[model samples]
Target: MKITKSIAITLGLAGILAFKQDKEVPVKAALQAAQVHLANMAAANTDVTQYPRSTKKDGSIATTSSRDWTSGFYPGSLWYIYDYTKDKQWETLARQWTAGLEQEQFNRATHDLGFMLFCSFGNGYRLTKDPKYKDIIIQGSKSLISRYNAKVGSIRSWDHHTDKWQFPVIIDNMMNLEMLFWATKATGDSVYYNIAKTHALTTLKNHFRKDNSSYHVVDYDTITGQPRLKQTHQGYADESAWARGQAWGLYGYTVAYRETKDKRFLAQAQKIADFFINHKSLPTDKIPYWDFNAPDIPNAPRDASAAAIAASGMLELSQYTGRSGEAYKKIATQILRSLASSAYLAKANTNNNFVLLHSTGHLPGNSEIDVPLNYADYYFIEGLIRFERLNKGLAIVSTGGFLTVN
Candidate 1:
């Protein structure tokens, strides 16, 4: 009997991974467990062909399809695990998941293409040099820039009309700028880079408070291109600082500085980091509440995703800021340690196989109120990989991790 190409690939993936367990034993174990959990979840939900957005209370998953912003994270997680372990099976799974997301290349409705395309195919191209992935990313970047409003100097985050906001730009839009910068590098197109820079500068001017904590939404006047309202859509209050928004600001500007080598972005990133690290509301474990100013104080639900992203951003930020880099690295290390502990990291075959638990997605709106999210695990794995590289103290990071000046 002759096996088809698809059959052969399936057989190849059927073989268990031969994890080269080394100093990064905890992370290796986590990724291995994730593979098993993901495989089991897919088997249990035979109707679902791909990973969903997140798991709910009863062990059911959100059926949000590939068009959802979070659709990239599951594939991105597979890619990061592949990069960490060099396991062929991870690569195969990564390719499979990423392929399902290919249709999102032209999704122009949202400003999350960076989260959707770049995290999946961006990492895929980085590791494999797949020209196909490169093509998709360039096209996706173009689609992302289409949402940019030259008059507003920012990318419009939502298409829906609001009574108060004609053009709403959320802080989360900051995460999408990396794809534009990548497009500039991949295709030598300055248009993409310029739009990202303008968006970032405009966001910097309006989204942050004097102390650097960020608002969740900065609705701009479509005609004047100036910020109209400072409000919170997902936070505790309209005036309160949401934890994840601050995390996005920290990570976003870190990448901005890395791409442009602009000192202002670096300064902005550090200030956001300082706001987080010094805030009295941050937990002793470094995990932040769903809202920094949540009325409940210590009893507020913690967002592991925010901690994960902030720690990962701090790892890269550490390498940039000379002496202060060490302090940032220390805070990042503490956050990573807390996240890796039993309280957050899921046990083997638990939490519906989600990697990290207790990420509060949208508390005020009552969505994903303390469940595991795909993005949380994605950033945790990414943070661990960066931590391992940081420990190596070698220049391997400059290749796969962050940008550094000579």
Candidate 2:
């Protein structure tokens, strides 16, 4: 080897690896796996632009139409893939999948218009500067905020499932506030921004227990603007922590802190992280059971979805604090490493083209249990992209993406 460029480059790579962190994951492999998985999903669905929300037990893709809350995630994930790998095939898939949800920009009945359009069309607009996607996102934000009740101080989460809940506000609704915040910034109007802050403040007042663990749902009385019940629909009990609900709180508050620079939201996020990481039930691997209160301890189903969301949110949260932020980054790195392991990640061409396996969704309701959810895949990709952006000194919610907690 007489100083050939190939030999010099190999030595240079070795020198670079000398300072590499042990927890630094090769998420590029995950990206390649995603490309293969998405291609398979496209072929399996056959011209349908809607996303695959879950995989059936028989290994078939269960596609969700644009009306479903999870319909945006598949396209959003594809956009992240394109952003990460610079692969144009992912761009094409992103656009095609996103087109299916165009009708959702005007759907005012559901609060998930943010999840439907912001995660898909918002990302599309940010990455491509497409005016059409921007228009859709603004319209979708108006539709999402239309569900907000000033008296209740929160957005109404459901309309069809009102038999048990009136003026329902679930922890999951925290995730939809980002679209409102982005809309205010894009339009130079504060009405959407004000509604987001009010909803977050109301949730902060009522949703958290003393220990900082959050309830899954908070049902408000429509007339008096009072909380009639503080119970759960999908958690193990009225007081138990639903894993993904806590994650949604964490991600939501982190986003709010970034947008408003509020110390309360930052403190709320730190406390929620303490509750999650220091909990007795959290597994050594950092992945959590579907419910912290589940009867089965070691035998409970793990929610990789929750772990993914927390990892992405924590990455953004780390930017807000100084020394404490380093700890958050370290734990988040460990989570990424854990999620990239064989235990959580699906093998190539397996798991019906889903990225991760063994996620529990609404186990208490006996639905979507032990399945791969579209949102899980979306956040997993986000964790990877956010990590890359952090190293490059870029923003976590690249182009008005939001995160929150507690």
On TM-score, the candidate that comes out on top is: 2
Flag regions of model 1 displaced more than 4 Å: 1-49, 396-402
Cα-based lDDT at residue 316, candidate 1: 89
Candidates in order have lDDT scores of: 0.81, 0.81
Q: Estimate each model's TM-score.
A: 0.90, 0.91
